[model samples]
Target chain A: MGKQVPVAEGVFTWPSDEPRLIGSKCTDCGNVMFPTQSGCPKCSGQTTETVELGRTGTLWTWTVQGYPPKSPPYAGDASPKTFEPFGVGYVELPGEVKVETRLTVSDPEHIEIGMEMELTFVPLYTNDDGDEVVTFAFAPTAS
Target chain B: MTTDDVAIVGIGMHPFGRHEGVSGMDMGVSAVRTACADAGVEWSDIQFAFGGSAAAGNPDTMVSKLGLTGLQFINVVNGCATGGSALFSAYNSIKSGMFDLGIAIGFDKHERGAFRVNTRSSGLGDWYGESGMALTTQFFGMKINRYMHEYGISNDSLARVSEKAFRNGSKNENAWRRKPLSMDEVKESAMLSYPLTQYMFCSPGEGGVALILARADQAHKYTDTPVYLKSAVVRSRRFGSFEVMAPSVALEHNAGPTVDASAAAFEMAGIGPEDIDVAQLQDTESGAEIMHMAENGFCEHGEQEHMLAMGETEIGGRLPVNTDGGCLANGEPIGASGLRQVYENVLQLRGDAGERQVPNNPKTAYTHVYGAPGISGVTILAK
Candidate 1:
């Protein structure tokens, strides 16, 4: 595989032994958010501190993408010929926020709500620079 | 209190389906002409106007086709609540005594897969879309999945909702999906998102709808059977509420905006859910209808299963919903969607709806529209 790289910068800590999703917590309202927002949505305060979020969370809810999404917006190979269904869901990092992410499994029967899930990474696609770009996901903790 | 005396005098719609050669504005112009004729008024009679479309261009530009009477025309573009917001603007125009008469209009022509949103344009992070997590259907799926698990809603109930939409669509001439499909067909249709089948979702399509509003006291001057606009309310989602296009949600699942809009509509109308004779709830997909029934105060959370099993939402049932078929059948032209509900409600109130009319001469009707970025609008009409 080509040198591993994150799909985008600032979403999570990269090039590390243990990467945790990056987020922001409001100093005023204590409301937390993903990917680190500069402003606090909860308290209308610009005062927010960048923080590393919990790596483990519970699967709050889930569903599978039965069809390939449209491109220009979608970077993955969405051609009908090679498209494979994948799971999408929200994972609740306790006392923080329920982060919407891609799930490791596609079959509905395989996953259940409230299943303990942990942060993981999957190859989204390859960049032109010969780097294997990756994206974040949550998987069954026991898996 | 200044806005309590508005009435819809006339309603018109350009049958919602594919019209290859027709531009969205052309449809809007035709609907405007028909509405004026139905109200027995000339285009010059309207003192102000508010209308909108998403894919379609600025609505105020229609003044060229509508004749340059130089009326104050405002353009609204509130995602799915575009039509409702336009109507609210027009209702207030007359209710506030600023104008004697006005028009609220909406129209749109969307690409076949137009429901697929581009997160980039919405100011979302690029990675959110690039990583294949931007699908709107996924949001609907997760939400319904969670709701069903929490409320004990059977898979069969989801199919039943689409089954009902198709059955009702078959009876409405203007609806796009006219052919009725069985519950089994709904259940068996290719799963677009788990718990939601292909047939369970609405395709994006073309259409236009317009309503003419006047002060309730002067409504009789135009139409003898004026339907009073008892209330028109729009509400946005609170921070903790689970809504579309969210990368993360709050742990505390607060009520969505529909609950707020629904309650406010009933409050402004001086009536409760039980008093509404018939209704049209947003049915973007089968699951939305199921959830909205309770969100709009039609029933309890877990009662949808029993309600679907008993056909309580059917045309002849206790509370007829989407009597002219909803987005699940008519398809969604986001701009025109909300007003289409109001159009159907007006027909029901006037007893002008032919074979699909609700029984016992329905005196009151409610229309609700909910959509992207988490907003809901509700309108109550009374005869």
Candidate 2:
């Protein structure tokens, strides 16, 4: 479930006590990129600092998945026997950055775009050692 | 302004679908042959050529597939606007007095899987690592979220757009998905991306479209009552920024809180939204069609749902849009979709749309093509 790969080096740590995604911020343009870009796209300046993303945000829009994604890159650990149609949505942090992730909610019909949401990590797939590889996901904030 | 600018003399299209047997080059050549025949011209008469395609393996390979015969060939690729980009290239070449005759061909046969990446390129790094960032569907999902926040629009409104598109597509011979759909059906469909159901997104269809552009002075020599290009304008977003401005789509007639490229297009065309008798907007996705209604100045932002409720965007509505059943129904072939819009406008203006035709003869019409991230192209045509 953890690896010290180049993309994850320094910026990302495995099983942190506090779960969050690490992004490099370009102080010049105030732009934050995921998977951490070495430099800012706006000013061509190096990303001087690293930052952690908030675990809570607002749902921008959402829908339920009816089919498996075509690529293996997205194949998750849930067995077809255990697979249930799940909802997905985009959550907007107050900072204007948006991300796409799975939605955890009781009912898909009630999901709306502007609803408040919180982030959680979900296992996407299992590796050779049968360890679960988790990724960030989101769910509706409790009313 | 005296009709010496440009005219489309020939229009041809390959059937839209998942064509596994034919290469993009084969499709483009087939469409070009038909267009040349329709225009009563020989291959040698094509003084200039422009090729458009999104995923043809290689850009140069796709352009070379057209076999230009060394007659001033140009290649253009602008995501979904590939067809429009090609058209614009030929139109400009003729308008610039460089050539009196030109051909624009757009073709595509999308790969049957996730989008590919150029990891092999030396410059690949940074924002380029995650190819998912460029996925148009996710970007539009964000816009839908904002639309919901500002307008309080309901999902039913978005579903209805698909309902209309599916119904129309079912009747279209060239459409990919022929089954008619209901709002409930659309609502229940599998989610491809948040805020975008499978029905809302355009399925990749393999096809090619060819258009012959002749200078205005020579237009009469080709055909009478030629379709005139009022204006062709394109706008692109500032790279490396998250700033979302008003989209430039030309659907809305009223200004909203958002900013778009349509205002400038209207000013250039010397006509307002009210003057447009027919418009063929790029409806790559259902939410996009609804959003375009506001972004293009057809109505205020977030007013699209109510407008749809009133049956305003239907074929017989006050503002008939996507009369040929938009990309959702007709199938989107990326590079060919834009020219397909122009072809539909030409048919409507020429009084040949058949069963799906608009009632009154439309003298003025508009076609808009948008692409990945934030690229917009608006073209005004008149008879």
Candidate 3:
């Protein structure tokens, strides 16, 4: 295996057996935001702290991306010959926030609203540098 | 100042479709000329211009088509709310007595496929885009699925909305998709996203719309039946509202921009949703129309199913909506889409909508447009 690389830096921890999403928590309102924010969007309070979000969440809603999106940002292997649709949705991480995410399942029939899910890393694509580009997604938890 | 101080004296549009070999500027010129002719005013009479476009070039280019009169020509780009924002600007300018006659123009010619994502411009980091969550279609699908589950809205109801849109489009000569679709056909359309079929979504296309506005006192000088601008309000997202293109949402829910803008418009117009005779709400997708009906105070939550079942949203229904086929049939040309809503409302209010005209002469009309990451524009017009 060539080295592993995250699709983007600073969104989550990498190279760990168990990784969690990085976010910001408003010390005043206790509000949490993913991808981190400079300040609280709610109370507009400057006081905030970095925090790790919960790993488990429930499916708020979902859909199958039957069509491959336009390129540049979509660096996946989406050639018409090999393109396969996938499931995407919002996962409610309890009281933290509803994170928009790609689901592991591609079949809409297999997914249900309010289904339990857990955060996990998945290979988005390999870069020209021969490194595995990983991104975050939610998958059905065995529990 | 009161919104009624300004009035729409003229309205026109370049038919919504693929204008092969036609430049966006030419389409805009055509629309502007049509509006000026309809208003019985010469280009020299206009004092100010507000132009909006998305993929098309700067709106100031319109000065080349319509002679530059050394008047203010401001260009606007507010996602899908572009036209509505321009209209708002013109409304304020006229109401402030800064100009007696002003024009708002929206035109666009977009390349095919889903709207290209500009991660930087969208305020989304590279990770959000790389995760494949940036597509607007997925957002609509996900939001509608959650809405259906929470409100017990059925798939058939979703199909019914599309059916009505196409049926209404069939009578609109300017609409891109003019063929009526059966419910089964709509339901069986290719699945773009879960619970949302291909027919449920509106594709981006080429179009242009223009409106001529004047002080209410001077409107009769241009036209005998000027459509009064009762309200023109634009709103941004409030914290916690479910916004398409948002990377994440707050734990607590707040009213979306459509609700906020519509509420403000109703207050300004001095009319409730029930008081409006005809309406045009954003139908970026069929599900949006259903939810917007409730959001705009036209009906109660979970009341859309009953309304659809009773045929209350059809052309002859109690409150005919999207009488010009809406975005579903018009194909959303971003900048022009919002103003297209106003143009359709103006037609209905003037009793000039030929085949798709609402049965009773609609004196009051409501129009709304909602764009990504949370923004909404609403305008109420009266004859």
**What's the TM-score of every candidate structure?**
0.98, 0.84, 0.98
Off by over 4 Å in 2: A1-11, A29-35, A38-48, A75-87, A104-106, A109-119, A139-143, B57-68, B111-142, B191-196, B239-259
* Cα lDDT, model 3, residue B249: 86
Tell how far residue B17 is off in model 3, in angstroms. Answer: 1.0
Q: Candidate 1: where is the Cα deviation over 4 Å?
A: B1-4
RMSD of 3: 1.4
lDDT head-to-head 2 vs 3, winner: 3
- TM-score of structure candidate 3: 0.98
User: For model 3, what is the error of residue A101's alpha carbon versus the real structure, in angstroms, after optimal superposition?
Assistant: 1.0
TM value for model 1:
0.98
Q: Write the residue-wise lDDT of candidate 1 on B163-243 in tens digits.
A: 888888898899998999999999998999888999988888999998999888888899989999989999999878999
What residue pairs clash in candidate 1, if any at all?
none
| Interface CA RMSD, all predictions | 1.2, 7.5, 1.0
The 10-residue segment of model 1 chain B with minimum total lDDT is B1-10
For candidate 2, lDDT tens digit of each residue in A48-75?
A: 4777766787775555554444332234
Question: Where does model 3 exceed 4 Å of error?
Answer: B1-4
DockQ winner = 3
Candidate number with greatest lDDT = 1
lDDT of 3 by residue, B83-193 (tens): 999999999999888889989999999888788888889888977777787899888898889889889789999899999999899998889999999999998998888
1 against 2, candidate with superior TM-score? 1
> Model 2, residue B347: displacement in angstroms?
1.3
Instruction: State how far residue A60 of model 1 sits from its true place (Å).
Output: 0.4
